[model samples]
Target chain A: MIDKRVGDPAQAVADVKDGDTVLIGGFGEAGSPIELIHALIDQGARDLVVASNNTGNGQVGLAALIAAGRVRKMICSYPRSSNSRVFPELYRKGQIELELVPQGTLAERIRAGGAGVPAFFTPSSVGTVLAEGKEVREFEGRPYVMERWLRADFALVKAELGDRLGNLTYNKTARNFGPIMCMAARTAIVQVSRIVEPGGIDPEVVVTPGVFVKRIVEVANAAHESVLVAQGVTYP
Target chain B: MTAELIHAGLTRDEMARRAARDIPDGAYVNLGIGIPELVAAHIPPGREVIYHTENGVMGFGPPPPEGEEDPELINAGKKPITLLPGASFFHHADSFAMIRGGHIDFCILGAMQVARNGDLANWSTGAPGAIPAVGGAMDLVAGAGRIVVITEHCAKDGSPKLVDACTYPLTGRGVVARVFTDLAVVDVTSEGFVLREIAPGVDLDTVRRLTGAPLLAAAGIKTIEP
Candidate 1:
């Protein structure tokens, strides 16, 4: 039996070293690994290139991580959220760099990376500024811009349930980038609400199989930035 | 002081309703933010249209009941939403795959400007202070089978939004099929912008005068359904 369970959040993310590209999965605040993100912050990895759908909202999770001066750059679609302030301030002051990909392109790049595709042409941002200096080709008489694959050193994802072997299930929209992130990274560390045995989950419902997952961290109460904002939670 | 008259067009909800009429039954539609989002409320009962939100959800139903809003469950614009019975959610990559893969039948998006050649520019004005937020408009416009642009007829400063060329950043070129302005419904054909309908109480002369391009009246003028 290949058990991928880790003792705690610290151990789960202990392998993520400085200067590694980390793919943190989430859309807005849904499906974000807040506890593991906090643990990563405590781990104090520096000069990391963080790729995500959004930066951080409120002052928790990714935003807090950025505030702590951990991330050196971010590759994302939408970096701003309702309560997000840290990224903007750092972005303007030239402390961090940004590679803004269209939301669909970002997701597709990750998906392509996981499927072992090195590059693919897409029509998403053909004529926009995002397509500048990229290879453009005519496929079936329609123009498509070539997008390279995006892989991460490690991916921190949030799942609703996980078996010891790392078969993961997810919550609603919270599953936003979890499944794809697991496949696009070398080491996938999932934060689950509950941990069960290998045979605990029905084979049919396993959204992300254990083969892609490297570690599973059980965090019963996964804090979300959206929930915190709803509850009027903030930080100075 | 002499009294002056002002011209106004359909309300936001009315524009949404007009756009909804074009959607066929069982169409997998993606509604962009702003006026397009209102189409969900006006989706005429009995139409089995499945709504897709890019934040990773399909089969949007209604606004969730008060106090039942789930923070984790939200639309692309980050607003809480309700899910229909058969609604499914997935990761970001899958959501975009559904979009770029051409699974969506139609897309109704809000725009800042649309060109006579069907070019769309809604994401940014490229102004110094304007936030450059292009979520999924480019992907939907480029991949959806057809694109319907719903927007106010003109900017608040009295500049027309439907122009010969877009002055803002282009989201996609030659992607828009139809444009539903507050005052008129126009189709973007190879010929040019053809006026299809005029808002109630509005005249063809008034619409022609306000349009920035050479507008041709359609053979049949349809009513702007509220």
Candidate 2:
């Protein structure tokens, strides 16, 4: 009888305010909480700092939010894609800021946040320009760059299926950052394809327990990026 | 010996095939973008090399069918890919843990420049508007059991890529194990760049001159079949 379902996607993100840092889960088109992102875009939150992988592909997801001038900054690995032009255009004009992190380092930082670790040493950026000005220490004769945790105010994620209590399951590689983001954020809102009773999802199959999830919004026929690729369109 | 024209060296695909030959059977390998990605195509048939894409895909298959492209199944590069039998996906953190934990056996990467002491620099040239995207190159080099660099012998202006020391930002220090270039296969050892195999039609002297560092030919140097 436990249900975390909100009235709708907009309602799911109603608490977001300007200048709040939000973490979005995905790897390009996979696992992006598009409906929730669209809700935030429509909700008119401005000057928001968003952290994600690849800053969304084209105008299909987070790029649309960026196009609306809602995002003030982005912390991600790769922000360039063949179909994505909004970010590059905005970035070049000095309209938006970027804090680029190597993908593995980014993931570890978020994991560290969720695990309550203050900071961790990583070799990913040890000798690269990204390592400049950071604390560096040698571990067993190998230098490791010090990386801090990246906790977020809110985390928006997408999943293939979820129960009323918020136990989530994912489809294919779309599961990329969903679970970790759920743990790293103060409040985790999920957009899912289906909502079932508690027993609907197999106990062994739940990748993210409901404890980390705060709200669930059902989104049917969600616009995944495959739809864009099928049209043979390259740019936004 | 019949002397030939200056070496045209091997093609990119040929360089990729040479890099592929270095992967051991049944090893879990992560291929970096560009030259390293081509290694997947040249992996010998029946070889059990499990390809792991940093975006959370493991046990990779060939590219997806023309019209059957699924965005959900794309690799870290955002390109459509097919999943081999038994392929599975996990959270991004878990994927990286596998990488940073040294679970991946081998990783093939493309280099902008390599120092004589096995230092690697490929992520950024510090060029304006160059994207500066360093997806997972550093993590692989820092974590994988072995790192192989595959690239052309020289820059577009014909400057040597394998140098006495790298001027570009280092992606890793003393990490590269092998270098497969258009002209030869070289090993990065304590003694510096040692020429292992010269491309067909390439003389040992040309290989030595083209290499920015000191090149020592192995006692029994083999010819790289084009």
Candidate 3:
């Protein structure tokens, strides 16, 4: 019985400590683990370094966490969102730090972190301002900038389905960073829409294997950030 | 000014249609957010193009009908999309691997500035206090096999977009293969901005005047039919 199910979002995120590098999975509101993020907010961990695609939209999820001053830094490709003002304001006043990597490079760095690679060379930011202060080397007559791997102390992810064994699947584009972040973290806590039996999911379609996942909390009906933002909902 | 005079040369959609014609059948294409996204609707009939969105979908279909939008099913621009028959989802690493690995055929982008040397500066203006958001622009420019930019001939303030050198931050150095502007179809060659086609009713002199860099007419320059 390799059951990794947790009772609630609070319990799932209870162990996150201050100064941990957390990978919050989502490309905007799509795959955001809202309940878990809100729970982490209530749990009151401070000075977190979060890595995600965007800062967040409106005043919920990642934005709320940032508003709560729980995040000290953001490592992302794009920090601005259509409805996000939290990151920009904080960034302007120098309250938060930012490390902007190109989207593909960010993905590859996380993949490299999970795959046990220390660093890799890429042409994504070569000769651009983003490539400044980095090591540049040419291979086969083409220049490439070296980017280091990105690992997190914990990864909070949202998934479509999960079994007691922790194997998971995701919904559409929401699957963007979930699978990779799971592998790149010391502990991957997932909030799934449904929890099933061990044999419920097809083995071939499991996006995040049970090995990378530590805890699974069923969020049955997850709230979307767009609807929340539209309703002017602000998290605690 | 009459409407005819105010709306001169190819329209934005027409520019996209013209750019769409260059995409070969069965090619894997990535469309940047704005004007370049229009290229898909105008892709020639009978061509089976596989669309790739960097957010982790391949063979993406048209936008879902109104009211059926799924927030999770989206394109690289974060707009809702449908899954085409051959659609498959993968993680971010594999998605970018298809790109940086040189597996994608074409990537069409919108540009803020394009230098004669093919340098692009679409990501930022380098303005102080402006929060820069690069997204996948740099990756697409660096990895896509053929980088074609579709943009207006001039900026809103009437400054030339096709300039001698990009004044803003660079997305890539000498990466643009071709450019489709409202006024003309241009190619970025070692020689300079070579005009391949001229929009009907627009003269070469107007293009040369608007272009910040010198423009060269290619041999047998044709009138844009779209």
Candidate 4:
């Protein structure tokens, strides 16, 4: 059993070391573990290999890590304009390594890791560049490409609410990358705005149960910067 | 009543060429994944349509040749894609911004079903044991200037896919503008559904008979010119 309560974001993220592989859960700022990410950035961690569905918004999400020059490598489905400047420049200068995976395959790889399935096969990448250097197998007379599972040393996730036992719930798009990432990493750290007692959450509503989560921190305001940037505009 | 026969059973590539011809120069377009992706390959030379992808790529191009595939470049589906000049990648936020902000002028999406009222339900079929994924179809329908659907005319069961109403989960309500199927080009207008042109070798009545919904004929409907 893992402790659901932690001292602070810094302490939870302190377990991360240089050159460590980490998965930060988010799909464009929806469910990003902003507190832990801020801690990692503030700590000035370097040479990190970060894996996620997409980079954070510029100056706000995981892009901050790239902007801080902390990420030495990136494994993702796509690199967008928010972090686009960093990738090509670093690749040209031979400073960073970038590995792109098919989005569905990437999602499956992480899901497989969480499920303890070492590998699986799909036909999506066959005959494409994605099939290069990968083992190919035939099932039912059709070619299927095999992809390995993705595991990270640490997984940082954000949730809308959690129980003292670490069970979590997410809202809308924020749920995109959080639940699967929680199981694919060796240590799962979560940040939530509200924490309730164990058994307080309904089992049906729990997106990620307590067993997979190792630590949890409470953040007063996850979108403070974005709100400040928006100033007087009301957010829904 | 015309004697000119438009070719039926055209290849997917040919359908792509037909679709690309309708996209005017200087339009910002979004190509849905799968067969719709081929549209980028057939873009007419000298046309300046900027491609916006949900994965945060704009000014997109075709896939790179084998051995030259850059792992860093990919499309909305996460497949490796190439970037044209003046292309840029941004965080997913900005990518959705381009979509939801109405910066896109055209969206050419593949469809499972299109209704007489122009309702589109392409994201998930809701079929048991089928893959369930909705992606960014909702944003494309609501944000793009025009929503064009590209798909085949019928299912394997020989049932017409163009229906009175979509049976599958709808990505948007009454959002489609025009549709290009294997057999015909139809427009969803305020008056009703109208057949603009039929594919070569297919008659307008045959096309109408195969469709499940009521379809009206354009005043000067004819076989589509290649």
Interface RMSD list for the candidates: 1.4, 1.3, 0.7, 13.6
TM-score for chain B considered on its own, for each of the candidates: 0.94, 0.94, 0.97, 0.92
Residues A73-124, candidate 4: write the lDDT tens digits: 8887655532234454555576767676655566667878888999988554
2 against 4, candidate with superior DockQ: 2
Superior candidate under lDDT, 3 versus 4:
3
Off by over 4 Å in 2: A226-236, B1-6
Positional deviation of B3 in candidate 3, in angstroms? 14
lDDT (Cα, tens digit) per residue for candidate 1, span A1-236: 68899999999988789999999998888888888998999898999999998888867888988988999989988887678888988887889888988999988889888999999999998888889999999999999999999999999999999988889999888888899899999999999999998788899989999999999989998776777766866443
Candidate with more favorable, higher DockQ: 1 or 3: 3
Model 1 chain A scores worst on lDDT over the 10 consecutive residues at A227-236
Residue B163 Cα positional deviation in candidate 4, in Å, after optimal superposition? 30
Q: How well does candidate 2 match the true structure in TM-score terms?
A: 0.94
lDDT of 1 at B128: 72
lDDT per residue for candidate 3 within B76-113, as digits (tens), equals: 88899998887999888999999999999999999999
- Which 10 successive residues of model 3 chain A have the least lDDT summed? A73-82
Best by TM-score: 3
Score candidate 4 by lDDT: 0.74
